[model samples]
Target: MSESTPSTGASSPLHVAVGILTQGGKVFITRRFPDSHQGGKWEFPGGKIEPGEDTLSALKRELREELGIEVQDARAYMQVRHAYQDRDVLLDVWRISRYQGTPHGREGQEAKWFACVELPQLEFPEADQPILRRLWLPPLYLISDSRRFGKDGFLAPLERALKAGARLVQLREPHMPLDEFEEYARLIAGLCHRHGAHLLLNAEPESVSRCNADGVHLNGKRLTQYSSRPLDDHFWVAASCHSAEELRQAERLGADFAVLSPVAPTSSHPGAATLGWEAFSRLCATANLPVYALGGMRVQDLARAHQAGAQGLAMVSQIWGANSIERAVTALASS
Candidate 1:
């Protein structure tokens, strides 16, 4: 959840809210009835805080009243003060852990749980999209070689992962039929856009245009050819860099981000020599642009990379065909 730390000065009325993020990362939300205020809308559970009530106390009361659930742990994630047509509201979003009772609608309303990607399909209030973006972010990134997981393909699985909280994705679909690949690319782009996620396509500028994805991912050859002028404003340009020289070259070309791979060797690439964590840390610390650990990676490696100055992790295959997208997303995000 992001706080409304406005970059500029603006004053608005103060209203507060809290969201109960349940186990496996499913968020508890309530749906509004038609003809009510912002009626027929779904939003995080919690209501306005009184003049004297503390954030936690107000959240507990709101949960108990709205959903009939007892909140155990309620801590603030951020404070968002926004102005509405009628009044100002200061929203304090909190992740609720344990509750005493099952959540049921009190005022002829309904409550349900959903993974991040699936949330957009629901009738949530427009104001809640920012929180959904935070829910889509993962801690680590796994730079992948296409079809590493036996040719069922990456799109379906990655969609599941993205639902689970994967904020960033890289489309390095090599060796696949370009015509067929465009279909997959379009599917992934739609998913990312719905969930507020980032996507980078490896060079294949044609794919970026046809699929209308987030941006381009440049390989060693493409990185060297860039001259600072980008083809599109919507597409972010990232490069693959293996050394300091390569990193500098990528930065000079205005690459949005760079993937520094071989951070570790794994079953995916048995013949490749891996760069141990120390060297990976050194390379990341010295780089000017944001860096992601590319080689064989897991959800757990995000903390290690973060400490070493990396932005986040990327992955393929880990997110596909999963039954519990929420669990997988929480694992990646918390890890």
Candidate 2:
């Protein structure tokens, strides 16, 4: 995430709701008219929410008006606040769980369904780029906890995890010396790139460019300090959040996702207060970015996390063994 380009005025942002309607493996998208704002760009089919409307109702109504489909079931996905040159807009994005009727462009716009992976190649508004990246993430985010497995010992299991289909990895060695950490990050980044997984350097924005990593994961303190994301749009920025306010701050800083911690009691920090699933879901609902349930989470908790509005789970100890790593990713991919 890079520093947000400041908006000139302090006007209240307009609220808009958008839908990602899916069928099979494809999601529906629409192209904006050449003469409209963000003209000639591809976007998910949706329109603005009315003053009295909630996101769900607004989504359902907008889908009918824009695409001639009735949304039967839909789930809130991500909320995005973007400042364009014209206006500051808050997008309430939802994933259409189920819908009825054939979809076509009712307003003379072009509509198409595309496989999720193919979306990046198409042109979209700058605000929509984060949403596209969020879609590429897998359900399990593996954070390297080298407490038990020393620096040298962690690589093998990590490799196994990557080979087994772990699409997201975070190299989080806070205790390691800078030199050692850089070396390890470089090695891990190569492995991740080779396996088509994305690697994030924990709390080290400066190291990302040096280590060839995909992004940086800010600790809570750094999350609070930085008003903008450190990197450009090509990099993925994430933060560790302990409370709803932190999660909101992460979104405000343009973070692509956040890992909310202590969702359950943890062995490392025994007796620490946990958010539990109910509280975790409550916090997640407020975030426009994808949220991962961290601290004491494991592969088995992935489905529950998703139900609680988390994009996935971020586990430390549970993802460190070859067999466990393989199984974790297998379950994640299957889920």
RMSD of each: 9.6, 4.5
Clashes of each: 13, 2
Candidates in order, TM-scores: namely: 0.54, 0.82
**What lDDT score is found at residue 91 in candidate 1?**
66
Q: Write the per-residue lDDT of candidate 2 for residues 1-335, one digit (tens) a residue.
A: 11123345676777778898777767889998887778889998887777788889988888898899999988878777777777787878888888889899988899999998789789998888778898887788889877677777877777888888888998888898999999989988998999988999985699999999999999987888887878887899999999978988998888899999899998789998988999999998877888999988877788899999898988887666435668777888657
- Writing each residue's lDDT as its tens digit, candidate 1 over 235-307 gives 5677888898999897777565788877887556788888778998898877766787766666567778888
Question: Top lDDT: which candidate number?
Answer: 2
lDDT for model 1, please.
Answer: 0.68
Q: Each candidate's lDDT (Cα)?
A: 0.68, 0.84
Weakest 10 consecutive residues of candidate 1 by summed lDDT: 1-10
* TM-score between candidate 1 and the true structure: 0.54
**How many backbone overlaps does candidate 1 show?**
13
Which candidate number has the best TM-score? 2
